[model samples]
Target chain A: MVDHVGLLSAFGLIDAGYRQAVQVMEEGGLDGSTSDPDFLVATGSEELRADIPVLRHDGKLNPNGRHMAQQPIELILLKQWASYLALPVWLIDDSGNLLYYNEPAEALLGVRFEEAGEINADQLAEHFHTTRLDGKPYPNAELPIVVALVGRVPSHDTVRVRGLDGVWRILAITAFPVEGQGGRHLGAVAMFWETHDS
Target chain B: MKVTLWGTRGSLASGGPDTVQYGGDTAAVELRGPAGEFVVLDAGSGIRPIGEQTPSGTKRVDILLTHLHMDHIQGLGFFSPLFDPEIEVHVWGPGSTTLGLRERLTRYLSPPLFPVMLRDLPDVTLHEIRPPASFALGSLTVRAELITHPGPTMGYRIESPECVLAYLPDHEPALGVAEFPDVPDWTSGFELAHGVDVLIHDAQYTDDEYKSRVGWGHSTFDHALAFAALASVKQLVTFHHDPGHSDEMLDRAMAEMSESHDLEFELVPGRVGLTTCVD
Candidate 1:
């Protein structure tokens, strides 16, 4: 068994917080050893993990470890992966429900995911005012997230979005459908960065 | 409401002496309401003849495409009204995550595929539809809903003042399930087809053929009948015939199905140029 903790630590990927979490996990009788790095990434106990971002392995996450009986593992992994991303990331379900947006995304949207919760596709359209580069109001049908949710394809476009702060920001957005094992459409994820002002 | 089947064949256009009785065109169906609403269900090769026979003084025609599969949209460029600047041609298709309707259609309508680009076409407008959406074309109200298919495909429910007609030419309502018509609410395309006056649905394979081609996004006659029964549709017009099945084969299959099954609704084999008035 390759010690994942020592390996990730050797690569300088683990910080002080991650080391402490690992120490606590080891103290709690987890054995804290696995041949596969990904297995170690996926099976962390909830209380020990806390808010510390853990990299996913082979598209699996078990925040509640083997006890995760509810949400799909793929989504849990994606949410964790997104949380660690410095770039703004938004995760939506197959039905177009807003599932999660990371801390970086919350800064840009001017709201937190906990407060916003799961916004349905229809309400999402009303929440953000989007416009095309030519200043025409962007049709909901053309939005990258809408396209990704409906068409199940990767889409990229530049549009202006009005944040909750009432400021319009030009963002070059790329959204792609996330399909799980056996070609199941898990949902879609969108990552956008602020571009030049409109 | 008057419904006309211009093309009944599915997959590919299999025109030959063997297909003469049933017609070899792909899926283009035309619907007209008493209030003068003209709608084309798909742009399959069958659409060519319908375009040739377009009524004079027709101002606008809405082409509601279920999906962008080649057999479905093959007759689009050949549709004459797209060339007429005097008429407005609206092509409504299922939206994709990758490209807009115009861009996706352009791949087929332009360059090495075809001579004229979708952009070069006159009086042609592209409309992207996200299913479970309701819209109106004149007096006819149309409800588009996403169904179980390979891509972003939709089944349409068109309701007029007199009658309701549902069209789901390419659907697999029993993809994952072991026993079909599991639950009314859980069945794919159930709501669009439920209790409609007429349902034109996919019957692309026989039961045995479907076993080998599961998840191919087409329904077997048994599956279609089950769907129709669950929806309580008054008349079920079997559509999207497999390209390999000859007229004689289809006739024999239809006969076998009718003889073997105790069905509740009227069943009719879809044939090109068959017209029905639902009242």
Candidate 2:
């Protein structure tokens, strides 16, 4: 339950890194900064259709995967790290709220968190119908993300998750637990890629 | 009854001189009843030869598919019977929870992946058949039992008055012991193959290969041997040959397994043209 406080900004590391990402995104789509790895934030900058909300009421822009008190230094860096990359990144608090995601993920979710307001995991699960690569559904409890939470271990699963567009894209999802402060559990993070996108 | 191994290769169809002896065609097996009835086990690349040599009398081709994996259904569009106006192919297979056999087949058989759609194949009629059930599809009494696979895969037991032949082209017996937690132990493999005239079981992996690939839905030769022994099958034809295994590799495997085990039944290597009398 211990979320390491201000590890990134206290060192002026990810704060500078993240703001630079937003700046690059604002300039143009992902193509603007080919030199920088995080330039992918630029790809969907025009589409989110709203500013990154300053909703500090619960310290989350949206009720993402889960809710919790603080963001571990790893999760903080994770948030910044996800903000730049091209693949879809999703982070949850210990309480299971959707905390942060990059622009590439915004395109897949159908509703960008910026304009759509705060949405919880329950809401996001609605957009996805999880199944195997051949379109066979696993019992919800046995799904890879759920299994990681139960096992407290990192897990990789390959399944097709359909977004709101009703297009079932085969995604390889990797889910891992976030640990901080003498190995206290914070939450989980997942990075997913549409297999066919390659 | 007569059983012919049209294609014995698993996963993918690999061709070359290396695989020519056992054949590189994927999953199709031709079963002929003494009544001159025709039944095809799967539609793997092996079905191509079937299309070319198919007899004219039986216009209705009974294709009992185990599951709709690409390797199992890859040769569907290329099959010659589908192009003929008079021939009717009755395709039978298991469906996903929501999708019927038609919907599942149409997923791959239609445009983008293939130029022809299921609707265009007017002669082919798809039927959804759930296992833990039995049905008659001619003189043959067909019993479908679900197997330990990654999906809703069924290993069939085709019985005639003369004898019974069980076919499990792709199965993971060890997985039956550990997975499917919601269900009780899966003994379908044993139930289907037990005391049967012939058992065409999946022998895609070696003992070492099975260790790392536990849930891959295919069995090692050792596991297949042990299973066949326990079930007391009269004849064991190790089917679903791994694509990477050359003919020499298969011969070595057959010899190795034969010499290694003092078994009750004869262990035979499944070759493309190999035919066994189901008596």
The candidate scoring highest on DockQ is 1
Error of model 2, residue B193, in angstroms: 1.0
- Compared with the true structure, all predictions reach lDDT values of 0.77, 0.71
Against the true structure, candidate 1 reaches a TM-score of 0.61
lDDT of 2 by residue, A161-193 (tens): 888778777788898877542234556788887
Across residues B1-279, which tens digit of lDDT does each residue of candidate 2 receive? 999999899999999999998999999999998777788899999998998998776577888899889899998888888888888888878766556677788889887999998898768777666444466667877766667677778888888889889999998765534332211112346656767889999999987877888778898998788778766789999989898999999999999998888989988899989998555
User: Mind giving the per-residue lDDT tens digits that candidate 1 earns over B62-135?
Assistant: 99999999999999999999998888998888656555577788889998999998878878877776444567
Task: Indicate the docking level reached by candidate 2.
Answer: incorrect
> How do the residues A1-198 of candidate 1 rate in per-residue lDDT, one tens digit apiece?
014334333433335555565556566644323232212112123342342223221333222132211233346446656867899999887656567788889977788876875555555644678899888977655678755654556899999888777888899999998875323466789999998965
Please tell me what DockQ candidate 2 reaches: 0.01
Residue B30 accuracy (lDDT) in model 2: 92
Which regions of candidate 2 fall more than 4 Å away from where they truly are?
Answer: A1-198, B176-186
